[model samples]
Target: MSQQVQAVIAPGENEPVRVETIIVPDPGPGEAVVRIQACGVCHTDLHYKQGGISDAYPFLLGHEAAGVVESVGDGVTDVAPGDFVILNWRAVCGQCRACLRGRPWYCFDTHNARQRMTLASTGQELTPALGIGAFAEKTLVAAGQCTKVDPEVSPAVAGLLGCGVMAGIGAAINTGQVGRGDSVAVIGCGGVGDAAIVGSRLAGASKIVAVDIDDRKLETAKSMGATHTVNSKETDPVEAIRSLTGGFGADVVIDAVGRPQTYRQAFYARDLAGTVVLVGVPTPDMKLELPLLDVFGRGGSLKSAWYGDCLPSRDFPMLVDLHQQGRLDLGAFVTETIGLGDIEQAFGRMHGGDVLRSVVVF
Candidate 1:
């Protein structure tokens, strides 16, 4: 049977999201219905509202989420009812070439619920953001998208592992391969960059430098384990990063801001054979230029950290356990909790730079 539930929706391009009644269908084979508990407000959601991601209007806009599985369809042996889980956008298909090669994290064919949620009023199918939209009271998703985790952890904190948090930490450990005694400089003090700091600290980095225009964010980065803070607005970030690392630059430099200028800084800010990780999202129109000789001479890897090169099944549960053991503080990423209706204001707070994350708690 289908069910009617209240959900937030972007009705059109650049349209302000408003509450609407959506019809969620019963799970089909290989699908599950989740009663969402907490969903984080992320910049990607904002980009969806502005039509930056696609022309697919009326997007169901929430991806970073956690919930309880209310039910699962036939053939879904992995997850059963009453299980606590964090929703992930990547639902890997094992038969893909990448998966067959034992690199499922790079699975080319990720998926979502086969059924579509529709507007109760007009029955128009709504596009689920990242295929795991959880801004609603409940959402249907493919069974593979739900990764069971420790129920003891707060749903609010667990939800963060779904996206930005995972991306940042993955960028550091998985993509950049940060290790003990390594030096890391994260360019950007937002939630993602801050997570990179935490990851570096966990990996036993000897020094962690945070570069950002805002002092407040830099301070937050410091509290999260940054050993040095550089106000890029005042100083030449590339030079400062080198100075902080004893003039050799860091072993790994991550650009969480993803802009041409920041990328250039990252390119030049690393040691002669140091790695540069780009985790920040950039617009399509943006272009980058660097001397061909420099690219060839850098001698190290330049990587774009896609969802932090994370494998959801492996990383999510491990991170949850880490948090439970107090080795990871996932709660710090959540600045405040608000009701679903407050998402609009939460978006405002996000842009105002007053909050790291404003989570919608159901």
Candidate 2:
């Protein structure tokens, strides 16, 4: 059996996402059907619409979602009907080399639901965004992709742990390995950047610096645990970060805005031997032209954080527990909650930097 539901779809490049009727199939083997309760509007969704991700037209959008499992297919044992879960895109295949080596987070063969949701008419098939489209009443995903979490928290809050929040927090704690009393700087004050600030604070960083072109986001960063803010428009950010860190740059500099310029700034904003983490999503055409000598002279690791180096099974529960304890302040990320129809407007707000995260609540 299949279910008919309304979902946001990117019909073509630069076209506004439309809410249309989408047909979601029953869970196939190793799959489960989830009745989505909430999903966050991440920048990745906008990328999908801009043809930045792919030309997979009529793409079923929304990935960072949380909901209750409605049904499970044959051989599905991880989650049963009635279980609440946060949908994860990376469902590790234990046989993959990364997983076999005990690093499931880097599993190269992460799986998704084998069946594709599609348009009812013309028998046109649609590509599910990030393999877990949830901007609808329901979404189908690989059973392993649904990580069961405590259901006590509102779905709106729980859903964020699926993406941006995880990226930001994990970039600092996991990838950057920020330690207590360390000085951390996050370039770009968007959702991912602000989450990095919060993560630094949670990791006990003594000084958290936020750099951005927008003053509003800088203010938002402060509220999220930044000890200082730098409006890059009016000052040299790398120098300011250096001065703020007492003649040495931050111990960890994160480029949350993935661009060559910001990447350059992040490279120059960290102290010698300090780590520089790139958590930003960059364009395919964007190229780095740094001197090979400088790259070698940096004396530190230039790393790109894939999904914040998050391990769904390990990080999700621990972060949820932190949120439950009221110490992590995950609520700060929710600027507004809107219905599925407000997604287009939310994307505008996201580009305008007016909201941290506009979540769609089903």
RMSD of each: 0.7, 0.9
Residues 77-113, candidate 2: write the lDDT tens digits: 8899999999999998999899899888788999999
The digit string of per-residue lDDT tens for model 1 on 243-336 reads 9888988999999999999999999999988999999999999999999999999779999998999999899999998998899999999899
Using TM-score as the measure, which candidate wins? 1
Any idea what lDDT model 1 has? 0.94
Best by lDDT: 1
> Which sections of candidate 2 miss by over 4 Å?
none
User: How many residue pairs clash in model 1?
Assistant: 0
TM-score of 1: 0.99
Model 2's alpha-carbon lDDT is 0.92
lDDT of 1 at 259: 97
